[model samples]
Target chain A: MALITCQNAAFAYEGNTAVSNLNFAVHRGDYLCIVGENGSGKSTLIKGLLGLKVPQSGSVWMGDGLQPNKIGYLPQQTAAQKDFPASAYEVILSGRLGTRGILPFYSRVDKKIAEKNIKRLDIGNLRGRCYRELSGGQQQRVLLARALCAAEKMLLLDEPVAGLDPVVTRELYRLIEKINHETNITVIMVSHDIHSAVKYASHILHLQNTQVFFGKTKDYVQSEVGNRFLGITRRQESGGEAGGGEGSD
Target chain B: MIDILLEMFSYTFLVRAVIVGLLVSLCAALLGVSLVLKRYSMIGDGLSHVGFGTLAVATAMNASPLTVSIPVVVMAAFMLLRISENSKIKGDAAIALISTSSLAIGVVVISITTGMNTDVCNYMFGSILAMSKSDVILSIVLAIVVLILFVIFYNKIFAVTFDETFAQATGVKTGLYNMLIAFLTAITIVLGMRMMGALLISSLIIFPALTSMRVCKKFKSVTICSACVSVLCFFSGVVISYLQATPTGASVVIVNIIAFLLFWTANSIIRRGYA
Candidate 1:
């Protein structure tokens, strides 16, 4: 059985349907990138998957022993996170909160997992440092490690490289790719960076309020929708192609 | 100084006020860290206004003010949360709407019934003598409960405040924790109103946390520092008020402001050292 099945799922926002007719099945070890322009309902879909919002007309079913709390998520940064008075380790340790239902303290196991994630992400040096004090790339890495603490089977990231410079952006994408490959953890990333999305994702799920395309990466690139969107991305990114050819493995 | 302190504690009203004020400020400081970080510091001001309105109605009805104000202020907090979440009213606008409306209602109610009496003035601006024996007992018991609850749920509250979306995605039930924070805040505001005044109760919530955050880089340190700062400020504020014959709430706020300035200066100095 698929890990998650969204059968005609729709989410209402401000009395209007933000997104609808989402029909997708995420299987084990799938590197699915959700790509769309801003306001294209990618975030709504992520919320739906996280069980934060109930679908209007359909259901999002979790199967293959997957639960809502088990999915690791790295949401976009909020204003509260800026100048937040928490150490990077504390933020990362909080990811174990999913497994800590009703428990007041972080267990020894939880702490060990946090430590392991820190080591895994090579962020042990920043463990005790304040989160807000870290640079943007470092902060993203810390948050990614935090998401890793909760993600046993799958990782859900919403625009993880949104504000990062190209060098850092490429680094983060490759790191995510490495995680997906090494751990065989299924990855569902929402992004508008179509070039990197095509380069790293095994599958592409494009949205313009509804599914414009959902298939393997190669097929998506050949499809008319993919051709148009990639063309726009290429044109927009024409001047900055320094590391463009290197991502293709 | 010790003789003055002894003489000061000799008065029963001062002792009662000191005890209640310490506990209330402690609770306020603890909740303030999360509230300030979440940008809901205004919620304290808003709920204190609701507290004023309820106290006004309670006084007019010849009822126990604490009992009347506590639940009403809590409900108002929930309503404010709901309005911000579901309605077109954003957080600041919603708080402003509720706060101004409540203040107006309180003023109107007081003018119609009590005609600006000493009790009304005490509730509005705070008086040390306003901490009656029964109110002290109630405030202490409630403050202890608030402290215990806050300690037990500290981890969850930290997660929720720092990142509600991530916490909710982790299945932390952010709504419940948000409500929990609001509820505790309401209880603190209502309890502190008679001695800290509805007009000044929010300072007890905001100032200590902000001052501590200026110096402390971590949440645990910030919370600990804020608690100590608020408690120390409250004690000294009360003592100063007694010695100089000033209003309790205003003195405390002034002390907090001074502490904030000192800590901010120290923070800048420390950062410069690092640089």
Candidate 2:
């Protein structure tokens, strides 16, 4: 069954359309990556998915109850987030907020889920440390753990690895792969890094001006539009490097 | 000193003044951390101006300033929220335009109506000596209500401040919470006007949070430390006012500034030594 579905969605800010005529669906346990260049409305699309921005004229349906907690989302990073004053544990535990009763108290079961997620992310030692003081990679992991703490079925990430070093980016993608494989959580991430998306995504959606390409990764790599936009070449495959997609664009 | 204490205890207004200052300080200090963290410290400054405008209008109309100011500032707060949420207008610019316009209109109204040499300085700088029993009860009740809201919605608040989009995605209704915060801030500013004054209230909102950051390593600790520092500054400022014959609000703000400087300096020294 589809975990999320957006049909004929069009989103605009102040009457100026940012993204339009978008249609997509993600089934349970699917890993879908959305890639687009700057100003291609990737962020805007993500916002619509998270219900932060209402589409001008379309419908977005999530799970049966259509509650936010049923799906977790990670927005693009901000400088304010880097300087935020919460500890890793505190930040992670905030994910359990929606699941709590109206009294706004966290129960023992909630605490256990938070702790278990922290441990699962292997951020156990950083639990007491301030979130701001951590390295960029560590902060991203803490945020991921926070998303995991509450999310039961799907994870939506908006360029989660942006602005990170190469090593950190690779590490995060690996971890995301682990999350997809182990938790069986459907992952839909907005990304600009084509290589990472190609490496990790089971399916890819390339969003360009008022258009999109959606298909399996293998077919996407070989598609005429993907080859043109992503610049993939067969010769570079022998070198076994992402630069294989460098020249065609 | 003992004679002064005896004299102060004898007056019902003095007891009320102390209670009002303590309660307002406690609530403001806690809520202030969130405001400062979110970089909406200016919202306190803006709401205070709205309070001043309401006060002037109410005074001119011969109505109770408290009653008039609450609804007026509450409506102004709602407008501020609506304007900020208008994705077209930038948030800070919206706050600036509303605050400046309201304050300017208030000044013109006061000057035209009360040509009788209005002591606006007292409102701008505060006149704790002028607090009454009813003001104390009002402040105490506001503080209690704010505290209850904080405790009940602490997690949601924490999430919203840290990651607003994520909070909304997790079903927190960030827009509603954002409006609720703005409303609470408006009420808090009005309640605190007697203690911190219209001009200096934002100082109380920012300093305690900054000082708490120096000594605390966690969000909860930062909140607790800020509240403690605020209460200590309140009592100390009252005492110092008696000693120096100065205004209570200015004295309290001064004490808070001093504490902030001392704590910041100590933190810098420790960091340098460790490095």
Candidate 3:
């Protein structure tokens, strides 16, 4: 069964439509990357998926015990949020808040899960360090671990590599790929990097204001929208063309 | 100096002032960390002005100032939150509008009714003998309640203060917690205004948090150090005021300023040592 289904969904902010006529399903173990232009409602769609904003029209359904609150999320960071005075361990442990369920304090199992994710992300040494003092790559790793602690089945990331160096971005992509393939966890990511989206994601959801194209990556690479987005023609099979075609879509 | 200090504590009003001052200082410090981090430190100043307005009206009506002021300031706090969130009026603008208007109302009301009496002066500038026995009891109970609630919700408050969007995405009820902080702040401002004065109570909320932030890197340490610093400053300020005939509120603010400078200098030295 599909883990989540959205049928003819629409999202709006203050009665102004941001994205409309969205129909999609997230299957178990699927890696879906959402690609779009600026103001294309990628963040609004993620808000709808996370139940942060109610659908303006139609319906969003969750199945296979996949509730909205259970999905892990890694939000785009800002300068003010980066200056928050917290240790890496505290930041990651806070992700278990939904699971704790009105317990007032974290349980031992929550600590263990936090520790496991810290080890998984290879940030055990940085756990005791302040989050604001860490490098950009380390901070992203800490946030990723926090998201991992919340994910029982799926993870949702919003522009996770927005401001990172190329080397760090590549390392993060490998880490996310490892989690998706090894743990069979579903990955839904919003990205501006079209090349990495095509390289890493199994499925693609392309949004251009009200128009959307959701399909398999290979099928998307062959479609008109994908070809225009990826800057590829019917006869071209070269990978070098994928590099500069990032922000076009 | 010791004899003067011992004799000052022997007075009932002086003892009440110290007790209430320390409790208010602790509550202010505890709530200050989140307020400073969230950039809502000015809300304390805004609410204190509202409290001053309510207190002036309450005094004119012969009503208990605490009873009238607490609910009114809490409602104003909620209103400030709504205006900042839902309307085009930004947070600082909204605070300035409401605070200055309420302060004007308070000045007009006091002038119309009391006409610059010592009673009005006590609320504006804070006298050491301003807290009554009933005020002390009320402050102790309410301050304890605020402290307990803060401790219970420490982690949630930390999460909300750090990344409100992520906290809301994880179903942490950011709105409710924001309201909780505002409500507690309202209570703290109302309680502290009696001892720290309407003009100086916000310093009680801002100074300790900022002072601790200079030296502490973690939220927990900042909170702990803030509380300790607030209480110690309040005690020394009260004693200094008693000994040197300084104004209570100004003495407390001065001591807080000195503590902040000391902490900043010491932190720089420590950082240089590590470097």
Q: Tell me each candidate's i-RMS in Å.
A: 0.7, 1.4, 1.1
Candidate 1 ranges with C-alpha deviation above 4 Å = A238-249
Ranking by TM-score: 1, 3, 2
lDDT per prediction? 0.90, 0.80, 0.88
| TM-score (chain B only), all candidates | 0.97, 0.93, 0.97
lDDT of 1 by residue, A1-249 (tens): 899998888898766898888888899999999988878898888988888888988889999899888999999999779899899989999999988889899999999999999988899899989989999999999999999999899999988887777788888998999999999999999987788889899999999998888889999999999999888767656656523222322
Per-residue CA lDDT of model 1 for B52-76, tens digit only, reads: 9998999899999998999899999
User: What TM-score does the predicted chain A of each candidate obtain versus native chain A?
Assistant: 0.94, 0.88, 0.92
| TM-score, predicted candidate 3 vs. hidden true structure | 0.95
> What shift in Å separates residue A220 of candidate 2 from its native position after superposition?
0.6
Q: Is candidate 1 or candidate 2 better by TM-score?
A: 1
Fraction of true A-B contacts recovered by candidate 2: 0.76
Clash numbers, per candidate = 0, 0, 0
Give lDDT tens digits, candidate 3, residues A64-140: 99888889899999666677778888899999887876678999999999999998888999988988999888998
Cα error of candidate 1 at position A79, Å: 1.2
Q: What range of 10 consecutive residues in model 2 chain A has the weakest lDDT sum? A: A240-249
